[model samples]
Target: MDILMIVPASLLVFILGASIGSFINVVVYRLPAGLSVLWPPSRCPHCLNQLKAYDNVPVLGWLWLRGRCRYCKNKIAARYPVVEAVTGIIFVLVFLLFKVSILTIGYWAFCSWLLALSLIDLDTMTLPNQLTQSGLVLGLIFQIVIGFFPEGSSVGAIKHLMMGIVGAVLGLWLFDAIALLGSIALGKTAMGAGDAKLAAMMGAWLGWKYLLLAGFMACAVGALVGGVAIALSQRRFGQKIPFGPFLALGAAIALFGGEAILSVYQGLFFPVT
Candidate 1:
């Protein structure tokens, strides 16, 4: 399709991603506090005033208002708009790769939850069970539903669902075992319980092979980052760094091309591994 012809479609996708990112901001704040995300509308964090519709228009709203609350004129964190923009970019990139398909929509939902969990983990140093558990279920649902679409086959749907189940089980088991073994080896807490759940969620969505690839990627990246933190003296040698962000990045990469990346690694990149 011509780029001009898909302009409207692309715009719609961007808008959808940005809007969801705004909602993810709410979930990140409220979910950890045991607060209802849907009960209250968007409000100014400083003033507690309900935001007007125009003020809640994601990135544009923040830009229009100069990143300030309309009621109290308090400066808003630039992270809000940055989150919205990043989400829009992620969605656009995924769309460009996969176009419109059941699997693409599944990837969108997967990425959406992944972003929410990652931001929440960054803020709290903990991952909420709400997102990780729900993600596991949603992943299975996507596989099943995608299989039963009008153009899809029931047998294929069942097969995918079974594979999804295996992936989920292996994901949960593998990560949890890693955490347990690491803790025993290090004589301290090595990984949070939530990290295992997160791995399970990714496995449910992407299958076991991709999930393993993501795990490898996460560990390599996390080690590099943790090393940098220690060397910079920003973190103590034994200090714990939240691993969710690294895992989320790995999952996103796997969603795009885990197999190709694995091939590259096996062929010309990291032959020793």
Candidate 2:
């Protein structure tokens, strides 16, 4: 692509991603509360004043307002801009990786929901079953549709979809069992139920091959990050740590880079250790 075309295309993708991220913010905030996401316009959570059109213009609006509500001047959560920026970056990467394919769209859609669920779980330590169930259906549809396309074969897409469903169930049940066992062993719950549900969502979307990969990656990342934080803070062992964000990260990676990762892993550890 020409330099001029590249800049324009990149800017467009970034804007679109940020716009979607704005909608995702609504879903994240309201879905758990059973609120109508579309009915009410965006408003100040502090003052409940309906936002003007300018206020809803993704990242630019937040930057213009200096991250404060125009009416109430309440400090808006910095997460708004952060989510938008992150989504924009991810979109640009997706465009590069898939180049106008349905794979791009499907993964983007998956990430949108995952973004909401990750944030909600971060805040409340709960994963809504509705989101996970919906994601499973969507992932199945995406797999079958993509399989039919010329580049890939649809011959076994259904089988993969079944594997995904089974992976989801197994992931959730295994986590639950571990939680139960740890509870019995330690006299307290060792993991949050929300973590199990979120893993199920990952399994549903990624299928067994990538779902297990994601689970391992998520656990590894969570341990490394959480360990560093605990060590720096001098926190006690077994302190509560949020696991949803790591799971989301893992799922995103699996969806986008699973094949490459598997190739690398096979190169390193092939011949069945």
Candidate 3:
């Protein structure tokens, strides 16, 4: 691609992605709270004042307003701008990777949904069925439809989709088992149902093998982070910690880097081919 083409495309991705991220923020905040995403225009959480168009302009609006509600002057959470900026950055990266391919579009959609679910799970310690179950089903259906499409000559595509289904089921069951074992061992619930559902959703996108990789990464990261937290806080063991966010981070990593990780693993351990 020419430099001019690249520049324009990059700008478009940044602008559009940030705008979509603003809507995603609404989804994350409202869906868990049982508020309708479409109906009832954007409003201040504190004053319930309906936001004007100018007030809803993604990160710019937040910056312009100094992170306060226009009507109520209540301080808005910094998370809004951060989320928008993060999503915009992710959009640019994905565009660079796939360069207008359908895969880029699919992953973009997937990431937006996951971002909302991850934040909600972090805040509420509960994954709304709407996000978890709906994502699971939708991800599977997307894979199935894509896998069976066009000439149907690509047996590999079909295999991938089947693997996704198998992976989803196995991931769900494995998480359930782990949760059960953790509950019994700890005398308390260690994992939430939402975490299992999110894993299934990831499996639907990444296939069972990648899902396993994701689980391993999640466990490793969670252990490291939890240990650090314990040491920093000087807290005793058995303290409650949310696992869903760590799982989400792992899932994102697996989604983007699973093939690379697998390549490294194979090079170091398998090395035959």
Winner by TM-score: 1
TM-score of 2: 0.90
lDDT of each: 0.90, 0.83, 0.84
lDDT of 3 by residue, 8-122 (tens): 8988898888988998899988887888999799899999999989989889999999999988899999999899999998898888877877678877887887788878877
Residue by residue across 1-273, what tens digits does model 2's lDDT show? 777787889889999999999988888898888998897899999999999898889888898899899988989888998898888888888887887788889888888878888889887777788887788778778767766675566576766667767878877887788779988987887888877887777777777788888888888998899888888986667777667888898888887899999999998889465
Per-candidate alpha-carbon RMSD to the true structure: 2.5, 2.5, 1.8
Q: Which residue segments of model 1 deviate by more than 4 Å?
A: 266-273
User: Which should have the higher lDDT, number 1 or number 2?
Assistant: 1
Clashes of 3: 0
Candidate 2, residue 51: Cα displacement in angstroms equals 0.8
Cα lDDT for residue 92, model 2?
Answer: 85
Residue runs of model 2 more than 4 Å from their true location after superposition: 1-4, 151-154, 271-273
Model 1: per-residue Cα lDDT at residue 20:
86
Among these predictions, the greatest lDDT belongs to 1
Clashing pairs in 1: none
